[model samples]
Target: MIPVTRELVTGIKLTNYKDFIVEHLEDCPKEDKLSRLKHIWSMPKFGQLPKKPTKLKLLEHTRAYLLYLVSTTIFVDASQRSTLISYLQLLRDLDEAGKYAWGAVALAFLYRSLSKVADRESHFSGLATLL
Candidate 1:
């Protein structure tokens, strides 16, 4: 087996760190978590059920899954949540005045294009069925 070097490890982490941050930000929106997450706290018994597939279901499914994952896993403890809140604030409060790499801009454009492909206008494989 090939030996691992410090440079290799550091480069791998540096290359993917922004992606990790962006993914976390996308997965958990603070405002929505604050509002809907409390429902779990109040009830203390929420169940997960299978979802029905639909033509325009991709975006909605993504949202619901993100909410469920966030509520079920993150912010379950008050003390840990405070630390998480500080780090999230740092991401939100980026130094826009200074020059910085904006990877999310490229991701946003990519997401828009992929969403267009999912639209009925693109005709996914030139096939269409009306409900």
Candidate 2:
């Protein structure tokens, strides 16, 4: 099993208004959490789910998955980015802004895993490469 850190879990809890998403996973009956998450994020400025998505229907699955990960999980505050930068100092995969962008995406996944917000199987796994 992949090891999840306590900090990651706490960060997610904070984001979800102290809801212990990990602890409640067993009770939540929604089997298709990914679909629900997609619907949630796809809502527009009025914050209402549309009868039919206005955007491209074919790519909705992938788009929803990415928004799900980005909106619900990832957080990159100053301190968090600093720590990542320090740990990955030797590598030069991205410049400052690029590194920060990647860090934000990574933190989202880390939060999702630690909080058990959605099954790991439901993640947008190839997002970084595709982007």
Candidate 3:
């Protein structure tokens, strides 16, 4: 079980995330910057996507869906509006992504979030659904 650290999560800056989106997504926005809590293909944009997408679009959609899932559920933060795009890096190769110890990472994040609450944080984050 590996410990989750700031570097493991928040280390990837927004610029890097934007760069990744541009490099990967064919339909990436020309602005090349992430909106407040919204990434290029955020959850809200899912419905607008083509029903019959190409292979690349399917992969992109899958990645976007997974990102929404993790950001809103397991690794959720206080704002709940934005997610650390660093997770996308791991999601690049879905097959390889399964190799990660996701449960351990979620547990570690939950523990960390709980510890912050003990230190006077007003709101609880992480996988609060477990509690």
Per-residue lDDT over 58-89 for candidate 1, one digit per residue giving the tens place of the 0 to 100 score: 43344344434433332222222222222232
Positional deviation of residue 11's Cα in model 2 after best superposition, in angstroms = 24
Error of 1 at 119 (Å): 52
Global lDDT of model 1? 0.31
Q: Whose lDDT is higher: candidate 2's or candidate 3's?
A: 3
Q: List the residue pairs that clash in candidate 1.
A: none
State the C-alpha lDDT per candidate.
Answer: 0.31, 0.31, 0.66
- Model 3: residues with Cα > 4 Å off, grouped in runs: 1-15, 27-41
Better of 1 and 2 by TM-score: 1
Q: Cα lDDT of model 2 overall? A: 0.31
TM-score of each: 0.22, 0.21, 0.74
Per-residue lDDT, model 2, residue 48, is 37
C-alpha lDDT of residue 16 in model 2: 34
Q: Compared to the true structure, candidate 2 yields what TM-score?
A: 0.21
Arrange candidates, best TM-score first.
Answer: 3, 1, 2
lDDT of 3 by residue, 1-131 (tens): 44333233322454555567655554444454453336434755653569788988888878777877878777887564765657777678888666676777788778888888899865788877766
